[model samples]
Target: MASGKWKKRIRRAKGGHELEQAAALPYRFENGHLKIMLVTSRSTHRFTLPKGWPMKKRSLADAARIEALEEAGIEGKVSRSTIGHYLYWKRLKRVFIPVKVRVYPLHVQCENARWPEQKQRQRKWLSPDEAGLLVDEPQLMSFIASLDTDHRA
Candidate 1:
């Protein structure tokens, strides 16, 4: 469990400042080259990282790991420290709310044969450069392009 800001919840606020979420940046070193995994959005079928709201009784990193498993069917080691963060707009019924996401680095161990949301999402592995093209957020695109080398397992 986490305390302080990580534990706060806000339904609505100005500039979407009250909205915060956790995201998993799934990656692996493939033959010395970095590869990132992107999943299709259920409604739009657009590409994006696997993300969701924080869950009760879970660390933000653990919450992010669960999102990866549910949305992309991948399991792996998740870093307690965030690699970085980015902003994105989440579509609701009649409004698109901005969300600030803290990204946890996930070193993918394996993709499951079956998992939740498997029927609703499609997963693809691409180079950091390739992944950047499909990722809509400028900050996320830059984050992928850089792909910080100093990650701990």
Candidate 2:
């Protein structure tokens, strides 16, 4: 009972599974000040860490590195160990999809890389406490707190 155009539209409307993503929390001590890199999205301008879905041909760590450079404009060394994982609902096709995220701790070497392609992106270096508060996820906040405590010891 539907037209060709309507059927095509319906086919396109079916949503797929939520993609997997990896994120990095960059931390460093600069001149006795604790600093972390936080990024604002290009579309939503939501403040978050640098993260993205892993590329088909690349390892998860490499994808994390590339995300940091593209999103935050920073080059850093990522730890081999995973800090933690989290889950959230992502909106797609007017439905809430579940997404799994892996988090890694990065030792940032440079914070001032240029990202002309990301016109709406913004990066800031905030103290651990401030960064923890800024992050939206509770699990991520706990990880940041733990990192802060570890740094203090």
Candidate 3:
């Protein structure tokens, strides 16, 4: 998809103001290959990166890290900068709110056997290409595809 088209989709999705959210792309190097940890959404059970609303007193990057820990049970260093962003509609009670998600890269150092929401979500490690195929968002897929190369935003 074209970048402008995605932006237009984002604008159309949010007729009002876009909610700011953060996400973590938890990753690690295994056997000289990059592996990314993805978690399924509790409500939809669809493959997606750990993401949530902005938390008070936490930077977007830190919020992303916290979401990863709570949702995926994985932790490590998170970049202070965002590598990329994507637009997605967040389903609420009766309306689907548009959300602008700032994605931060996290270097996975540990995976906990027990963490909050462990029972509510499933985590899986996949190659960048595999993850890109699994997620439904096009911009998110682009971010996943760039995992093998160094990127900054």
Question: What TM-score do all the candidates reach, one by one?
Answer: 0.86, 0.80, 0.87
The digit string of per-residue lDDT tens for model 2 on 25-102 reads 888887877677788866567777888766789777778877888788787898777788777665544455566778
Which 10-residue window in model 3 sums to the lowest lDDT?
A: 1-10
Whose TM-score is higher: candidate 1's or candidate 3's? 3
Model 2: which ten-residue window has the lowest total lDDT? 5-14
Give the alpha carbon lDDT tens digit for every residue of 31-145 in model 3: 8788988999999999999998787898999999999999999999999999889998776545677788999999999999999999999999998889988999999988888
TM-score of 3: 0.87
Residue 16's lDDT within candidate 1 is 46
Pairwise lDDT winner, candidates 1 and 3: 3
lDDT of each residue in 39-95, candidate 1, tens digit only: 999988989999898888999999999999999999999989987889887765456
Give lDDT per model, in order.
0.84, 0.75, 0.87
lDDT, candidate 2, at 53: 67
Off by over 4 Å in 3: 1-15, 151-153
| Top candidate, metric TM-score | 3
Clashing pairs in 1: none
Predicted structure 1, TM vs. truth: 0.86
